[model samples]
Target: MADDGLDPRRWAALALLCAANFMVILDSQIVLLALPSIERDLGFSGGGAQWVLSAYLLGFGGLMLLGGRTADLVGRRRTFLAGTTLFLVSSLLCGFAWTGGVLVGARVAQGISAALMAPSALSVVTAMFAEGTERNKALAIWSSVGGFGATAALLVGGTLTDALGWPWVFFLNVPVAMVLLALGPVLLSESRGRARAYDPVGALTVTLAVSAAVYGVVRAPETGWTSASTLGALGVAVVAGAVFVRVETRSAAPLVPLQIFRSRRLTGGNLVMLLTAVGAFGTSLAVSQYAQGVLGYSPLEFGLATAVLPVMAVVGSYAAQAMIGRVDVRPVAMTGMAFMAAGCLALGQVSENSGYVTGLLPGLFLFGLGLGSSAVAAAVAALSGATERDSGLASGLNTAAFQLGGALGVAVASTVAVSRAGAVPGFRAAFDTSAGIALAGVAIAGLLLARPRRRRVPEPVGVTMSKEESTCGT
Candidate 1:
């Protein structure tokens, strides 16, 4: 054990960080299942109810870059603690919310807090773990933990909403957040990225760009994709994005350095994250809809049935972690994409007469497995060569990709599904499209994630490489 308390107990620190990440994931998903219940209790009008979710998405998706950069500017431990405190307070506020407006406001607060908490916690993981097998394993576990949080919310949310009321969903996060806050100081050590002056222009432009893009994507399903509102929002995103790039070029201390794009691994990993999120989130939506609308599964039944997916995800994550130690990340990621494609393809078999056992089970398992594997691989690859200075940015960028991808996935899948002859057929169409996206990811993994080969120097006569030595770096 080193003198630093965190070195010897790094895994434990990972657990705490992952727990924070899990809370963020859980809060997002848990609210989904309880939306109906919340609306009824709060007497929310039909159109207004959507704001509960949209507000949170806006806050979270838009501010991720700012949050990550803030972590880099401040200290990771301080950011984590501050964010957790805000999240805790917001969760409490959500639980006590008597009106729809209050609840939505609280949710936005939670989203902002999460935007701060997530990148800091993840960057801490990269900082603590050395970039090798240990980091790979830690990332795998982190991915698995998030998977469990998402899946668990599906089950737990339904149960809580039915039995204990919708407030319990938010209330549950309070204790968990409190526990993490209490333990974190003792269990974790403080760390900061390279000190740099804040880039207000870069932050402002990127925040507006991302927030507008995500808002447009989220609204497309409700508002026509080509509607004036949607088009205007998208136009704003494009303009803002362009301005952001220009700002970064001129700024001495850009929030996200332009040089990060030069690394194929970083760029590829983010793209892969985006593509896989499209497949995974789209499939989850399809599965949920199919189970309830076509197959007539109750909320509880749907939750129970979908529970198996997370179990498979855990197994897949562990498998990926073990395999990553011995192989390149591209193959692992490609293999995961293949599994996702296969799962989506299998789900294309769903029909009105089909049952859960035959129709959804196989696809669910495969999708979960692929989700777990690819999430870990892509995350590790995204942060592959990151130092402390850019670690937070890397985390924030990956998270933003995931959020944007999920929004686009849901919007596109829903649109495609509805455009077809019937709901069931539309779902199948969406599943097929998701499979196509996953297949695209497989190709991208090959093209973008390939490591450059190193040229071998001819060894002197009688000289030999060690048993494990290779001509090229893995």
Candidate 2:
């Protein structure tokens, strides 16, 4: 790589940060693909097993802004170390878990830790690298690794489940987390957002509100929406949500500036991601189950099957890197999102009796291709206009949006599946419905993402102040 005003130390630091982020995303789906085996071994019923996946999404998504805000307030490097420590400890406990409850609890712990890691990781990269190529290169690599982790999770999880048992999937994080944690203190420089002061109330209320809402969504399929449990959760969500807004409006140091919504680009990218993720993550889980249960694939077979995603996404990520300099993200993202919708739509047509070779493989390939390219493009689009100070919060918000979308997708799909009464047909109908949802994301990505008449650079602007403490511009 050319100097581009970037130091080798900066790239080295970003590599470690990307590794940590990859560890978090990879574990999320890998566990899902490995779930059936884990459930059988632990003697957990199907619904009980859902918590293992749902809990992680809930925790990670809920506290994401808090994590980012803390990074800005405390110091990005400190937050990264703290998050990594918790993630490592939680991973160990998860591996040692003897009961379903224990595993689910540990997964939530891991997610909370990940919330801390997520924002710190990206924000640090932005601080280290100057805006333009140096920054874009680092972010491209970071986002690419994220896509790679998600795709590779299923395959690696499947293999671990087959060869080493499900415990190894959790245990797998131990080495990676340790390595990243060790590298961080040595390789990373200490830095915090230039903004002074902090908002504990803003962070706390928003975290509680989002968690409550996602919890309601995740649990709704198991508890009928009309039931007291569901109704109570919804009520909690409403109150928390309202309180969160009120606090932010009044807080001296707001967790997130409500004005970010003013950017049509940011909102459009977020909505597209929300829908795309709902389909992609939901499909990843649903298909993993279908392959093992319906197709009678062993864990090893299942892992190998999902290898397609990582491979295709890596290719797509690289392609996006090349195009980022030449093309507006709008066209690239829209194209990828369209492909994703088409891929899902194709998958929806698969018959119950269809074979992997004849029916599932084709759609999987296209879906994987779309997921790989669009994810990178969409991420860049979402965070494009952000300053280095708020990059962490931006990344955190993007992550939470995706996870929340997935959680909702899982709940909706599970509800549709359950209401369909049986597993196979239920899976089919739910997946088909998800496909339609994904297509809607395609249209949004296409119609809403702003375009420039020519290859253009983002408008130069001052870095926004964090916590409303002080003014900042880059």
Candidate 3:
């Protein structure tokens, strides 16, 4: 570390970490475009086809907290490399899968790998840069890269699936993972927490709780929300969650320290991320359905047309980063949410006869801008107040919130889109509901985050600040 408390190779390390972040996010969205090809090739029966996506999500969301805590206990670099190696093997398995069952299993493995990689990579970044302007810039780049990854998936997935085959979608990760594995040890430093005790009971209960909750929400659209299976899964989640909390409270070395929630900024930041994801994912689903189903655009064409969203998002992220250096996060976050609400409202005005240039582009542009800005602000706010020891745990909680929100968004939007009389009307209703959600986020941000009366200079490493002081200025 330098006198400034930043790593000497922080930029190079950031590039590598951002690449990993991009790959993980890419896999999440890329598979959506290739689902039909996967279903046909593997001879999927009934709704088993959806499992390709759901399996990944369940494993990723379920094991996320454990993955984060593991990083703090074991080692960040080792955990990241282990995850990357597993991801490489799983990608190959997915490419060569001969049956639907085999493919779904491989996808679950991929998700598990991602759960390990995501938080460890983020924790490494947080550890590398001191919390201030430097950290804000780094996170802005990370957030923009993530936004680019999702849209790039749409573009790349369509092109690869059409030109080569759906298998290439899986094959694409092989080289990237190989490169990360090669450079990781050379570029990254190894670090672990002082507390070395493992909490198996807490881990098991929390994992089960999150997995059950994710499964319940992911399946609710297919099976009626009121069905026995849905209720049962949710009940399991509730029970498991209670058990985990009890275990953590008693454990000498808990998986997640209950006191971490005492930071108002951390809690508020996570909630903002959750609500932002709810609107972002729900709107994406609604727009994709409208463009492909209603507007009659091929997958490739659709991808090409909507590319503006991510482009504008990249622009917005950098702009937000500059703004955050001067002002606090609360205004930036609220402004971003306001933009998102306006975008959704614009999308809700689309009709059957509307054109892309006039009806869709404007809404997408606004939404993408908001996505980039809000994501960076939320991330900075959430991690800014965390002590170095709890960084991994905080990163995990933030990620889990986003993933869970995504599952909820897709399910609720799918249900809302089909509830109306016609396709266009149903899509419009979903967009309108998404707008409402974004507006609610604005209110929550205002209520939860405090405005700092004055800016504070960055403190040196190992310097402790009061909880109230730490919550004020991120």
Highest TM-score against the true fold, candidate: 3
Model 1 RMSD vs true structure? 5.0
lDDT (tens digit, per residue) of candidate 1 on 229-269: 89999999999999999999899888888866666777788
Maximum-lDDT candidate = 3
Per-residue alpha-carbon lDDT of model 2 for 1-474, expressed as tens digits? 236555568878887888998998887677876677778888898568878888898889889888887887788899999999999999999999989889999999999998999888888877777755556667678877887787678788877877888899898899988898778888987777667577777777788788888888888888876778878877887887788788877866677876665555566777877776787777776776677777787767877776776677777767776786787677777777766766767666666687877767877787777776677777766776566667777777777777778788777877776677667877777778777786677777776566523323444343342222122111
Tell me how far the alpha carbon of residue 277 in candidate 2 is from the true structure, in angstroms, after superposition.
1.6
What's the ranking of the predictions by TM-score, best on top? Answer: 3, 1, 2
Cα lDDT tens digits for candidate 3, 136-165: 999999989987886677778888999999
Q: What Cα-based lDDT does every candidate model obtain?
A: 0.83, 0.76, 0.86
Model 1 misplacement above 4 A: 1-6, 454-474
Poorest lDDT segment (10 consecutive residues) of candidate 2 = 465-474
Over 4 Å off, model 3: 1-5, 452-474
What would the TM-score be for candidate 2 when compared with the true structure?
A: 0.90
Clashing pairs in 2: 462-473, 463-473, 463-474
Candidates in order, TM-scores: namely: 0.93, 0.90, 0.95
Quote the lDDT for 143 in model 1.
85
Candidate no. 1 TM-score: 0.93
